[model samples]
Target: MVDAYLSLGSNIGERETQLQLAIEQLNMTPGIRVKRVSLIYETKPVGYVDQPDFLNLCVSIETNLPPFQLLQACLEIETRLHRVRKERWGPRTIDIDILLYGKSIIEDEHLSIPHPRMSERAFVMIPLNDIASDVIEPRSNKLIRTLVQPDDSVVKYK
Candidate 1:
């Protein structure tokens, strides 16, 4: 199985429940096994600023599926959870992003591993550091822990 990391966030409906159910869905998928999950953090919205605060967390999974298939599974889970794509970085019931896929570097028309912007987002970095601090981020060749700094905008969710 290949080790992969995912970041999940929700700002609509029961936020925490959304995150939990997403975790359950991921675990139930055929080739994916949810391993470690970081503590949920409540963070301010990034792109569109006017939405409700989001509940964010990162997850580590072992999956036999390839990167594209893994991405498909995440999208399927989001659709099942009622995520709507109405705007760029818009609010949603749940958002699942594939952050890393076993040191793989992929740049396709539909997907980008290492998530392109993950290093710049505190919401993704903080929680990711919780579980995979020592994992090397291929692009920067630096530890996940060293690439991030605590931000005032992200706080531990209850």
Candidate 2:
């Protein structure tokens, strides 16, 4: 199975519960097994500033599914938790993003492994550092820990 990392966030009703349910669903998927999860962090909305603060965390998983298939599974989980993509970076019950897929660098119309913007988002990097600090991000050829930076907008969720 390929080792993969995913970032999950929620800002709608019961934000923390939404994240938990998504994790449960991911673990329930036949080809996926969650290996570790970071402590949840509360982060201010990034792109769309009008939304509520989000509960964010990252997970490391071992999965046999291909990148696209894994993306499909994440999307499926979001839908199950009532995610509505009315706008980019809009409020949602749950948002799951594929951050890294093994040591692979992938760029396709449907998905981008090592997630295109992960390096720039402290919200993604901080929690990712918790679970996969030494994991190399293929595109940058740098360790996850090296890529993380302090950001006031992100803090541990109580």
Candidate 3:
């Protein structure tokens, strides 16, 4: 199985519950096993500053499925959670982003592994550091712990 990391966030409805529900659905999917999860953090919205603060967390999983299939599975979970894509970075019930997939670097129309903007978002990096601080991001060949986290407000909520 390939080790993968997922970033889950929500700002509408029950935010923390949305993340938990997404994790549950990911675990329920075939060829995937939820391994470790970071502390849920409350973070201010990034792109769309006018939305509610988001509850974000990182998830480590072992999956036998390939990248695209894994992306599909994540998309399915988001859909089940009533996510709407009316605007980019807009408020949503749930958002699941593929942060890392094994040691591979992937750049495709549908997705990008080692999520292109992970390093820029403390909401993703801080939680990533919690579970896999020493893990190297293939793109940079540097330890994830060494990557700088944005100076944004992130509070442990759970």
What lDDT score belongs to each candidate, Candidate 1 first?
0.96, 0.94, 0.92
Kindly provide the TM-score of model 3 when superposed on the true structure, using C-alpha atoms.
0.97
* Decoy 1 TM-score against native: 0.98
lDDT accuracy of residue 127 in candidate 3: 91
- Provide TM-scores for the models: 0.98, 0.98, 0.97
Q: Which candidate would rank higher by lDDT, 2 or 3?
A: 2
- Give a tens-digit lDDT track for model 3, residues 38-105: 99999999888999999999999999999999999999999999999999999999999999999999
Candidate with maximal lDDT: 1
**Rank by TM-score, descending?**
1, 2, 3
Alpha-carbon lDDT of model 1: 0.96
Q: Write the per-residue lDDT of candidate 1 for residues 2-121, one digit (tens) a residue.
A: 999999999999999999999999999999999999999999898899999999999999999999999999999999999999999899999999999999999999999989999989
How far out, in Å, is residue 132 in model 1?
0.3
Q: What clash count goes with each model?
A: 0, 0, 0
lDDT against true structure, model 2: 0.94
